[model samples]
Target: MSQPPPPPPNQPPTPPQGGFGAPQDPPPQGGFGAPPPPPPGGFGAPTPPPGQPPAYGYPQAPQPPQTPPPGQPEGYGYPQAPQPPQTPPPGQPQGYGFPQAPGQPGPYPGQVPGQQPYGYGYPGAPVQQPAPPQGGGRKLSTQMQIIIAAAVAVVLIIAGGVWFAMGEDGGKGADAKGTTGTTGGGGKGGGGGGGTAADGPGKEKAPANTASKVAFQKPHPKVTYLTNVVGSWVTDKAYVKTGINSIVAYDLDKGTELWTIPLPGQVCAASRHTEGNRTAIAFEPAKATPPKNFQPCSEVGAIDLSTGKLLWSKSVTGGQGGDDKARFNEVTVGAGTVAAGGTDGGAAWDLATGKERWKPQVNAEQCYDMGYGGGAGLVAARKCGPYDQQYVIIQNLDPATGAPLSQFKMPTGVEYASVVSTKPLVVAADVGDSAGDGSGISDFFSIDEKTGKLKAKIAVDADRFAAECDVTEVESCIKVAVGNGRIYLPTEDHEGSGEYGQTNEIVSFELATGKPTSDKSDAGDRYSMFPLRMDGGNILAYKEPPYDKGGQIVSIDGATMKQTVLMENPGVESVRRAESSFSVGHSEMLFSGGRLFISEMMISEPSDSGVDDDQFYMIGYTTN
Candidate 1:
């Protein structure tokens, strides 16, 4: 059996019960929970040099504090108090630190009131109801539910695929001189050099100090079962996000709606990579009426992020009534090609004109493409053989023909595979249900992009690692990141080097040798940090706040591993609870140009408190 589950952490964020499409119990999978606190004390902070200006919004480093400011953390590196700490009113968790604003005032607009919807969120937040029924999939019979709940009892991600590793040697990746993504060439979607961070750290400037006040909170769009809200993209002028049956873009600084592109149905899958401001996505072709709440997830298309335009959307209907629209579980784009794949079949289209590149080639019973990963390159994950004895093939495809230019076969027992990095050629898998906690990772396999050869195998213990991957989606993985020739993952929340609460650190493993590196960064006491993504060679991570503290965004140097605090959210009650409400692994986080933005992956239905008590969609913070 895998390591036993850790005790439920104190004061978890509660969003809604539904995570992906299923509900989980305490210590919910992908939750933002920290261990119980040992009272509150002064946690260490990064202090600036005596005369030099401090980074971001951090106040000047603390000098010898002659006296204490009520409610403020009285210690080294803390900002001098402007006002005494606000009383948290009654029953509310005490907000840490001092006076971003004075004494407690009226309810902030974002506050959810007495009760909130059940969330697969930070633990302990009050929930109004038992987990609600999700929109799709068959229900578990009472007997199966009881038996399953008692046994594995992990997050049930029916949305994505798993990665693979064979025997002890493991495997590698694929890349050829192919075309797709933001490149001018619109076919043959293969090759590396597509990772967004392949360039440099974002141009986000530091504020006066590492403190913040909420810039804005986006009102929630009511949706049932908290479904169909997926994908977020940032453009030069707007923050684009996927909504219920539409794609919406809002002005970055102002919460103004820039534009909305309505779709006939809900989005089923969206690519993480955007090429030349355009990205690929899969959605249902028709809206659910009544008798049916889910349409076939068959249409694939590309969206121009800047203009909020659906460049083109088409479905496979076979030449002449040969088959119905082909359904897809995932879609991705790179080298100017948009590829979609699933149990139904695989297909690719030109991003520029929506012209068909190729039809599904592996439809025969022997093998079929389960999904495709695109960004640095396009690779088809093909499944073959009978149920009891199955294997997988990771193939770099020729965009125009959907044929393999290079390939790597995976071992048996590969239930699912999450493509971690396309160009660096890395894949992750639980192998044989080894990570019993639903984290979807047991090992990481780094493959040579050019030769499709396995470089090294890096094993992980799920209970000790904090990354997560969808069990069914080909590309949905979170917390773990790759860049600077290494894979970075956060350790499970453990006893901190500090006097109290649990914390975790981000550790790296060199891709070349699959060995641990000397470089590491801490989440500080009572905080847990996860690599958000790569900024050039740097790792941009989010530090989940402690119960009373605020969240933080930090940038870690690729070489020295020195961490620079980018933004520190306000410890004001509403903002603290609001920031804590967003699960780092389950939400969209964008920190750029000196601003930090986070939004829920899905918005829950109304809580017992009423529609007015619904959660917020997006929250923005700036150093300014």
Candidate 2:
């Protein structure tokens, strides 16, 4: 394939950038991504039509010259003139690809007709947005972000090139998929999916050649403000990802839209744990509107992943004086139960039928279950202690009764803990805020599930490991895997052996010994890799794209720590553009059965810049 043609002579130059505290030099001249000085005949050269567009903790690659289709804006990051929001064209089929006409009810009570199903929120009005940081600027339309990003693409080189779409808040909330599961990407890291026996390792057999092609892409559900889509899953029958308030399932191999489950309100959080094809999520009880756009994440629902269906939706009140509907921050499915935990304490329901098993537990200890980690096993992080001081108590719970089988109180000053694995019982936390990078993790604690005894505390520098977990979230850790008796994590990017650029590697630490291993898998010069989730006994990692290259998925041997490429994405500029745009530390990423899925944790509404182009909600790539 050839490089896209540059923009025409009438290109609108970007205005001076604002907000950087210190003065800086103008963009470099005569290098990759610099606006080209006109062709030999100068301004007379004809610019080809617009074309081009993909990373996460690794830096982003230089963007291709984004030629805007005629009439669209040319620069990115600047606000555009206000214009009326346009609904998707008629044939969109509820913002889907390879259409399935799933019938859903019309707008809710008081909702205006024709508003998007994803609920970009009263489409007739503009939503509030946080001001751009540092200097406080405005956003370029979500879809139009890349066109002018190319003009400044050279900056990514210094960044080492990965641009995970974490949104304005550093915490797109963490991966939260960090738990245990028996199927579908196995809840972050464990033995499940890829059809492997519980005792053995399995790798998705790659074609003799590992190259891949774009299977399909789902556009970002049009919304005028930032919205949390918040989920991703892979199953035997489908590839699932969220679109605003809707849950969509697509055929794993063909990318056909199998079904779409519409929600009454926006999804605030989703369980990474899947029991076969069933999962759950926490959503707002009602839709948000102009003046009261804020909705507490107060309701929980059980979902069937295989056949898109909303099994049930309900909420409860907390122990302390609280609203009739208690708000939850997390939800999980494990051992035949769907559990949700948050400010309102904790609640659980039978997955098969929405029968309530337990409501929020109230006590004088000022205790409550803040969140859970489930799937292969069920565990809860209970919060206790007085207002002056707070600490987390980890519990190995009986899924059916929500009773603690064993408990271990986290060390003082540890406000949050991510359950990396429930069966083996590993938890990660940023003790005393020691990890200053805002990644939310600095150490891993291995515990004995049966006795709740501490096995070892493996300390890792925030700068050394790629692992991340939102300090306020329990199952948010990503870039972590537990199996083969060890915990694995990608190392932070470092200068590579090449004359230029950067790279990183995957390293493991023994759960029993809490000792680092020499065993490592290199990402090669200019490339950086992150642990997505585990498949069977092997560690599945995503290699972030290097300049002029595309991303790759490799299976790392659990015992030998060696890697075998299973899928190598096409280096086609347009595809690369789409491939590199998800969150590395915070986004949902899954690879199994020769297919790879990546999605943003949350999507945003375009700014005043009404220019729309090719933004995505989820993207899938498949092998030959």
Candidate 3:
């Protein structure tokens, strides 16, 4: 179809730094300097027009332009002189587009008292005025102006030729819908819309192709800024990535941005409202940019949402105990306190006042997890050693201070996973086998958050070598969450021969009994791309297929499992899921209310020959 015209030619150009013109002196510092005098002419009036013969259907004389009352600026944002109005002959239409002269409506075709014809300019209509000259009438000299104009003309000619030579794809041209024109032709009305779904694994349904008709409607009664992003109902508004760093609050209906809290640097871990409506952001300086003494600086702070302010901040130096390359792995705020994990161990801080509560073990290089046990206390998991054959030490600290409540060890080694909790109970999972054979058998364990005691273990029969097959360890089951008397285990399956990985199958487990509740034998065994559970139900699954360039999300209901395809893209890249979203990675998928919040790391193409930088984004969906 004919494309819309290229942007207009007489578009006003953007001004320089001061932009058009600077304000006349910073807003009179304070008010009430002085009072002004009265108008020279008396207020009383009553001079009628001279009843003279009209010459050749023209009015007797032209009326001068009316100036605004004294004290107001000459024009809104412009200092141009206003033009005067012209007097038209009786019974003749006023100049076409412009309105009639002030205080006098054009003669109506035929109207009763107090009534007017449709589309007529009535009394009290705003006078139309031309806009001010742009760029202060061209600052260049006369010679420069001619040269610039000539150069611009030549450039446009060349550009037009190049655009035309590049053919219809490069410039405006008619498609099968209409005749070609130099630029934009009117759009053609169509009977149907286009639909697309990514061509990838899994059954994907195309999104609706219908367009909504817009109208001036009344506002919805329950609309509020927080409602769009707050999932307080059955699904609970869920977010996964370092939960503390970037806190996104949305207007429930449209998901508008309310505010964002910027950090000094990229964050390693974060948690939001583990205790109250406060967020805790923990970050370690990048390795190559470590602070003095080669120690990565870890910072934790609480954010106040209402005012978008940092309530408090604390710094921990040489106290963290993780991989020299690893960073702040965990940070949580609860019951007036905050805590973060380091290379050697973890540290706690007073939420209101940034005071060190107590210094715990120095596991600076070990993997760890932290969270508040509902209202019970603070809980954390620290790895005792390396992943292939390491142990995870669970600790419960006093909610008020960093006092140790209890410490215990899970039965299996650490493979870097999440610690899911159900108040009194927390579940943990990693890609490991009972014999530590590097087999892909999934290990699921539960712990008592209040006592840090081992509860139970469950094992899944995944392919023995599949767990170790991930070259970059990019895809795997990241976490195990417990709710409604069930546990959710998210896993991944990669099948393609591509550099960046993709997700295939996900599985769910009933960890309490240590058996596979999901039919993993089936290729369709879906898992959570992000942690998700509904009203604490047995259904725990989220699996994202490859992204297409511009596809639509569709819901899948397979006999027993229910899942939603969060994003749909058309190009292979758009459908491509980032490796950072899976297994021990910060990206977490969650479901709250009817909305699904999935955190995915976005990787841009390496700059010609440089490394790629990654950023996280939250995609949400509403089931209702």
Number of clashes recorded per candidate: 38, 20, 52
Worst 10 residues of 1 by lDDT: 178-187
| Clash count (model 1, backbone only) | 38
Note the Cα lDDT for every prediction shown: 0.67, 0.69, 0.39
lDDT of 1 by residue, 219-297 (tens): 7776655476778888878888888788888877886889999999989788888889999888987776665567888
C-alpha lDDT of residue 219 in model 3: 16
Each candidate: RMSD: 23.5, 23.2, 29.5
Ranked by lDDT, top first? 2, 1, 3
lDDT for residue 350 in candidate 3, whole number 0-100: 79
Model 1 scores what on Cα lDDT? 0.67
Ten contiguous residues with the weakest lDDT in model 2: 179-188
lDDT measured at residue 36 in model 2 versus the true structure, 0 to 100: 53
For residues 247-361, could you state the per-residue lDDT of candidate 2 as single tens digits?
A: 8888877778899998888999898888868889899877777765769888898888877889888887756536577788889887888998887788999988989989886
Better of 2 and 3 by lDDT: 2
TM-score for every candidate vs. truth? 0.67, 0.68, 0.44
Q: In candidate 3, what are the lDDT values of residues 36-147, reduced to their tens digit? A: 3322321221222367443221212345666666787677644467678655567866766557565544554322233222211223323233243377565665445445
lDDT of 3 at 624: 44
